[model samples]
Target: MEPLRTVTVRALSGRVGTVGSGDGGVRMTQLNGKPVQLKEEADEPGWEVDPDDDWGIAVVETVGRQLKLRREAVGMRAADFGLAVGYGEDLVYKIESGKRIPRPEYLDKADKVLDAGGLLSAMKEDVKKVRYPKNVREIAKLEAQAVELGVYVGLSLHGLLQTPEHARALFEARQPPYSEEEVERLVAARMARKAVFDKSPVPALSFVQEEAALRRRIGGTMVRRRQLEHLLGVARLRNVTFQVMPTESGAHPGVDGKIELLKFADGTAVGRSDGAFNGRPTTEPKELRILELRYSTIRAEALTPGESLAFIEQLLGET
Candidate 1:
């Protein structure tokens, strides 16, 4: 096995000191009379709290108070606690003061360090939802409960089917451009929506993509090849039905734009069409009926599931 790497912090005019090789996690090493943590991985996320998410804000604040209370109860100062938990003192204060969202891994470390018997770690579920954008969480919640989902995208691969590299490339190409952190966050959220495919009893997922979308090569050769390969795999899933709307079969109902319809086990459904009803998702039976009709027509015009998989495989070979 490779040796564990160590980090030295503020060693100005001072010799290094101390040791403890943790379970391949952040290890404590003393230097310059200050406690330091060794590098482990890219910095954990969930640093910033969404300003518009009131419920998420409240959850973060509650978790922060718990962390603060537990640390204080054990008579550990902020700096001491930070050293023990493998983070900076200021970061600890920020999380405790409700100025930042704490990452799930951090909670696990805190739970062990504070002897909370999994209480701190258990808070991960609550904090997990807060880490994502408000709109994303709302969408994810709907997808999680949906029993049937139908999506049509004329321009790009739907979020649930996109590879991380493809999604990152798309995000990076936006006009205003997203920061590295925001790109990572959005990608993570998109990936989480895929959990719908893994839900117990599994949701029946149906996706329709334009032929041009498959041939566009969005994320360069290797990335696009991987995406096409992934699409083939997903297409083959028993519960998933994928189709491609060939360009040659023009003048289709999908020409208006994207369509998304999600039906629940309770018989309730929500649908949205870019060209209809101002593009707002609606639960009204009439609106949903219209969207469903258009979707059914589009699906009828698109290539069959078997043909779609063959089409994607050909694209992969071309790459």
Candidate 2:
């Protein structure tokens, strides 16, 4: 296999700022302070919608154009402007060219630097609406359109079914960790996906969770207790079903890990697995069929929805 390529951002005076993977070979550029590394193959089909679809590109373009105009009006060169914003000249150029999305902080600093009277800062909200990383937005969109959804979770509560506190705790526990702003953005996006539960025509939702997941104290005693109580409440939903796969049900299909299958009204479907198919979500019928079979088997091995509620209650009482 070929070695991964890297890009090293450096200052004209010979100081490295940041290093990130590049498409095919090592490349060097000048930039200010360190910024997060950019992925080589940024867009993954089916995982994320095209940036052009959600006014993402247009918003970036507008913001970039405004920044450039303001900088030119102030007679500031890219390097000087970048220093004012605590970023690199290359990054400033990237943002101005609409090739990069400026972080909220970057815009705030730029606004102050250019003395734009809050104009740049005002773009933060618009940028945020279209700037989710990875496949989060796409997954949320699929969940929204799903007429019937089946889930098998081995380690944690599904995002849609989580309460705010539970979801916050989960995001906070991620490795490398997310910034406060990032955590808030993620939590808000996750919560927004729950709107499907209240749709005019309710969707059919089913979940099979490993027993261990229910017992795990993710966010301390009180948080765990509240989560259990919340689960019980959601279990009462008329259009939802919940089951607990006992630990004793060893050697189950779900041992491979989490699985999600969503069926839509138009006869199209999508499925995702943590263990198979390269872990990428797929819309292929054959892949969907396999995931459905595994999910069905996991559900079969789990306690009935009624029993699952009782199981949760038992755990709650123990807590």
Candidate 3:
């Protein structure tokens, strides 16, 4: 049995390949037990893909490269690494090839197994930085990557479900005007994040909304109606759960702020405390725990899924 190592090799056998491990885009190889160092090879495969300019592709490829490098450094083949990480070899290949984003558990195992010095975890933050709207970048990135999302929206609609008309109205209300082009770019990016809804093994989504959010006419009657309809459609998704916190229910923990909790396949969790207009704020362990407790408390106080939908329908009928 060859000492299994996970590395992105250059094939060295024709068709030059790019080297990398996970999100870092840095590659490593070994020659005679000595770690072979690789640079940011502009000549590596997919150099033409332009990681810097294309936020999503660049971040995805970077993570894949990092995973490949660290795996090889440990002298493990993709199958061996996947087995250790409790994933199928095919899944490992998908992650390394940038065809799939890794589940949180796989990344954690890789972190310890590869002795990656927290590089894998750091890539989560790096991807957030790549998305526009610097403030909600983390939320956008995480929402796009999460396998399950537990979210509370106290203000307006969540970004993913907001129609272009609603999004534009909200953005235009900003103190500083966003140029038409900037608005379009942001909207395009937001819509792209919704791809998660279509991801295979679609993530379980639970959205708890405040009654006020339902009443706030973001883009006027027509826009609000469309937004409500959209929510109705999404709530009906097989993997989605929708709840509403009634105004009559009285003061709850979320009264202070909006929050979103992302639970990855590995059981590790991260959270955000800001809305789309405000940049997404990362939650540390202590903070994440606090939010979790608050979320549990609030969910307990909110309406049931059946009641919530009826409530929304009642509101829609009124308007």
Candidate 4:
């Protein structure tokens, strides 16, 4: 009888391919004989293309065509090309058929294999933006320049403040369902938005989270614990002012839905709320004031910054 020992390997997943246990990249561990193969949660296979993105679609198709042409010109079949590039033939086909987005690494590999002379690699800039959802890219663009951001979310934590595990779970729980690829793409995009917190001067960020959003128990016990811990960390940031809106606080303007306000360094601002003005984004000063007033009220009703951090710490302790 063989006494089993666990071994771990770091690789990408979410795309089934030829790898450990024949499922692309598996983080195999914890077994008696053969290792228990587990999916690696970290890694974005570029991103699934948005159906509504005409420009993105065109770019993908053009690059894919170039890849197929280059491979053919080099006298390599899809399988041969896939082997040369270290990806599954099926994945290679998906990329060439424009059914899947080609990752940066894939482009680099393809460029080398097909001898495209850095032509394929240069497409990464366009491909990178195409990978994320259109709305996510737009929101990220707005966040990049905003000097102040005030956000209120009643049902869940804001994307910018979510941990990868927490964000992945949230996306996985969506209804009507997203494909495995879609989920990873979304999670990647959401996490990418967190880059706003890393800007040079850092933005003045404020978040008012409903008490229930904190207690919702997303992604199970460990996930909840980690989320609470992460939330506490973000809430403690010097530039961030976080508040917890207790259910006991009674009715408030934010009870209608989520609200987001971003004020730019140039004195321009954009505001949006699910409950107000049909949920369309607005730049008008009068409309912005209404949202501002509502947000102020919500912040007032929420637990103070110090109190919120303490309350979350208490929750984390229980978890």
Candidate 5:
């Protein structure tokens, strides 16, 4: 593949112009025998594209190529294009080189500035499909395939059981605060993982949540009320079980933190913990045994499935 040349493009009164590097003149190129202005400079930083992510890479590269072509077709400098699109020059260069993922609004502005006739903005849908961080997708995949899923949550509701409003509240409360678009995307992905509940041969699902998690009031009173009601409904599923460890249970094995186990019909399993294993998912049998033991003990100590439902109902009444 030929190396990408760095071209200084400037958007001038809605038209693109190229400034020559060596001489105080402009250089032009031809597209289908029609003369067009383009200039060459040093290459920008190269992005280390992930080889495992073919779809994501393809979408980004396509958008980048289209943006570059449109800018060049009209003779716009990257800096000038950035100015028109409400971004910095370096960001414009990164976005055009496929090193940065442009936000949807960025594409909208670029479409208008470059006079793309909606061509550039149309890429937003493709980009949105791959916008989620890769790790979340992997976890969602595991949840979708498991024959049995066990979870012990200490702080917040498990993603699989979160109501849309509750999940949105959690995402909105992140430290840096996700953009409105990002909050919507994350909530949608989280909700999609709930497909496990609707799968044929319905997976056996067990949840052990600390009492604190139930009473934390994640999304304030109204959201929390709906979330509790949602939990009561989920607990009624024949294949699902819910257990709540009372706050007075006092320093149990689960005090170490959250734990998760997923078992498949083929006897393959994976486990994760926020305690000893440092929170990374593991498939090793030894790690799986330890996680299973801890989870089993926590579930045994928690309130029985029927009692847990009553507890949630009581909490709902208090709301």
Candidate 6:
């Protein structure tokens, strides 16, 4: 039998850490200045906060722990693993140290080398879900889980339904132009988010669009036509309800900002405001009551379901 390779472990900050024996396998040496047993195959990637356990660690810390454990168990040194994965040893160190985000490719390579089943893939999704700007990622998460989404867009077509051409133009128009690759990635991400529409239990989506979103022609005539046609097709989904907040409405709470109210299976609501990171994932009764009141007011101030549909048709005719 192969002899087990042992490595020194040290407590850093408040978490366990292990240093390689310049090879594969790790053994704990100390934790929090005291000796503690570190199992080679035990699941200790992330911490759950009970009063008895530590809390206040970000999810990223857990991911770093998992990567470290997996890397050591496979008997590969950080430099060797980096070689196999096409990255520098320093990058591997940074990732294992929880100082940087691991790319999907790095995670895949680690998974293969460590025989990690699907843990790496799952971690990829978790990391992506966490790293993107909080507001956009949160909206993406709620969108995926939502059985019904009420979207009110003031400046442009709802992102999920945008074509690649339109999406690129929109993204590039940011203060700085997005690189070609960034634009492609952004478009792909948007398209993937739209898959919720195709789920077996399709989400009920009601889009209350502003007249300006249609009239502005964001990507010019061809892109605008495609966007309009896409909107009409999405509107046809039996589960989907489309509405337009007309200019003629004079004024409404919707005019205050963009609103995305998601209704989950448990009757909870999550929402994003117009600005970045301006949202709450609230399930508390008091917060829910407040969101309910505000949403109801906004809905009332906007057109009724029937009237909104007619407004969409009116804009469609103008096109």
Q: In terms of TM-score, which candidate is strongest? A: 1
Model 3 lDDT per residue over 1-319, tens place: 2243454433221112336577555334443445444333221222222233566566767788888977777667775565455454555776788755454556677787676767787676554344345555656767767888888888887777678788888877877886655565566556656768888889998889888888888878998888888888887889998899988988888887788889887777887665332534554678778778888888899999888888889888987
The TM-score measured for candidate 5 stands at 0.62
Candidates, ranked, TM-score: 1, 4, 5, 2, 3, 6
Worst 10 contiguous positions by lDDT, candidate 5:
39-48
Using all chains and alpha carbons, the TM-scores for the candidates as numbered come to: 0.75, 0.61, 0.57, 0.70, 0.62, 0.56
Greater lDDT among 1 and 5 belongs to 1
Q: Runs in model 3 with CA error above 4 Å?
A: 1-131, 274-286
Error of 5 at 238 (Å): 0.6
lDDT of all predictions: 0.80, 0.76, 0.69, 0.79, 0.77, 0.63
Model 6 clash pairs are 24-75
Clashing pairs in 1: none
Residue range 1-319, candidate 6, lDDT tens digits = 2233343322132233465676554433443466443333222211111121122125556777787877787566765555455555555676676655566666887677666776776777766554344336666887888887877778888887687678777988987776654555566567657768877778788777777777777778787777777777777779887766667777665666777778888877676555323554555667645555655666666677677656666766776
Residue-wise lDDT of candidate 2 within 46-152, one digit each (tens)? Answer: 11222444577787888898889878776777776665555556667778888667667878987877777787899987665554544676777778789999999
Best by lDDT: 1
Best of the two (2, 4) by TM-score:
4
lDDT of 6: 0.63
Clashing pairs in 5: 9-76, 9-77, 10-76, 10-77, 16-74, 16-75, 16-76, 17-75
Local accuracy of candidate 1 as per-residue lDDT tens digits, 197-218: 8889999999999999999978
Give candidate 5 misplaced runs (Cα > 4 Å): 1-54, 57-132
Candidate 2 residues lying further than 4 Å off, grouped into runs, are: 1-134
**Clashing residue pairs for model 2:** 31-88, 32-88
Global local distance difference test of model 4? 0.79
